[model samples]
Target: MEQTKEISALLQLIDDPDEEVFGAVSEKIVEYGKPIIPNLEDLWENTPNETIQSRIELIIHKLQFTDLAEDFRQWNVAGHFDLMVGSLLVAKFQYPDLSTAPVLHEIEKLRRNVWLELNNYLTPLEQIRIITGIIYGYYGLKGTEVSYTNINDFLLNKVLETKRGNQLSNGILYLIICDLLDIPVKAISIPKQFVLAFQKPGYSTEEADFASKIEFYIEPASGQVFSHKDIESYFKRISVPALPSYFKPLSNKKIIQYLLEELANCFDNDKEHYKKEELLKLANMLD
Candidate 1:
């Protein structure tokens, strides 16, 4: 009852004309996080004052963003980094109300389709064919070639919804499905591109010798599989040195960092400095 009285008192002070007083009240309200959102919404609905409504909206955004930041920090410290969760965190920046159920359902549907066709005797190339057939042929997911610079192409939820994304988002989705199905595919940070590698049997990603066991690479943008020699040729054509780390699989944290960097670049290109800075801050957290 005392807590209820305190909340009532705070809601009454929200309409104070003084900016400093309103700021202090807003700070106190936001400290309660999402539990206080319904109360704020109720106050906004009951009040006709535009000033109070605007203050309520700002406080709601602050509380929600604070909740998301805490979630990201918790995910980071939670033992193994989850790529799907990390990708969804980036998605939450645009969609604060984004739910994981739809995303997981979509991924699971794709995994089941691929799983039915996979067998223990299948070669690595055959496994790639099955995954590609389901992802690109059946599902018809294609790369967003025309609007490659669009920010939506970098978000996993958006990619799943639209069935079209840039290389990075598509690659992350591909990696997630493969990981779920116990496939040996992993993300490799090739220069100017993001792709997945099919690791040879007996090689674990955690093992130090995993780099030498990469069988081949697959471009998720179009589900095109290629050999290591092709990567070397492409590197030569681009004038980029053939660095060993380029072929190695990236950790979930590194993959999320790369996705953030791409998001920052998209914002930078559009001259949205605030969004760019925010994405860069998230990227730094992964580091």
Candidate 2:
């Protein structure tokens, strides 16, 4: 609900466009600088209605914008995070190809079928785990060419059916699964490896998991489970450069750091990455 005075004042301000009022507001905002924020904030909280409080809060936030200088500049310099994040999301679809068994879309359809099968057997979380397995099963198949369409019957029926190891690409496919499933699955990126994290709403409240190490999720295409040693080896392979002091066991903090790196990779600055669509996909996996 809106407060009458705030709406009336807002309408008057909109209609009149009083330079005096604007000047006064701007001047006071400039004068007290950051110090005035608290009082304005107090007024905002004291406001009786939601709309009025929101308006007042926006004003206060603007008044306090100077403090955001570093953040804003960083956002601008990063080439804007949104484009980066968007690119990253799309980039994962690029994978090494094997035999020309099928086009990308057909494989996608088969993958989706297997995923639907996996979904049938387990709880949401368990579904995610098995689907992750099913995705890896597609690896080293007759097809690697990626597209929005295409299917390899042999790979779908034979390759995955035969292979036992779950690959990391399953996690990549998990992203799409998440998109479809509406689960709270987050992919954390490491220099060489990746860790996937998932959180979900439960009957109680919230639950989070970061137990699966990068190794637990292997890339059969590469044929190795990622490990701390693997990260060092990857850096060494890239020659970015030298060996580090120590390799640590996987931790949730590392998951968060990796997640941020992913955001950094994706360039999701100044955007609402959280949305119903993303959440639903995650929910399917995380639940």
- The clash count for each model shown is 0, 32
lDDT of 1 by residue, 49-151 (tens): 8978988987887788788778778888895798999999989977889988999899989999999999999998999999999999999898865253687
> Poorest 10 consecutive residues of model 1 by lDDT?
266-275
Q: What are the models' TM-scores?
A: 0.84, 0.28
TM-score of 1: 0.84
lDDT of each: 0.85, 0.39
lDDT of 2 at 102: 38
Candidate 1 residue runs with Cα over 4 Å from true position: 1-23, 43-55, 146-149, 204-212, 265-276
Q: List RMSD in Å for every model shown.
A: 3.3, 17.1
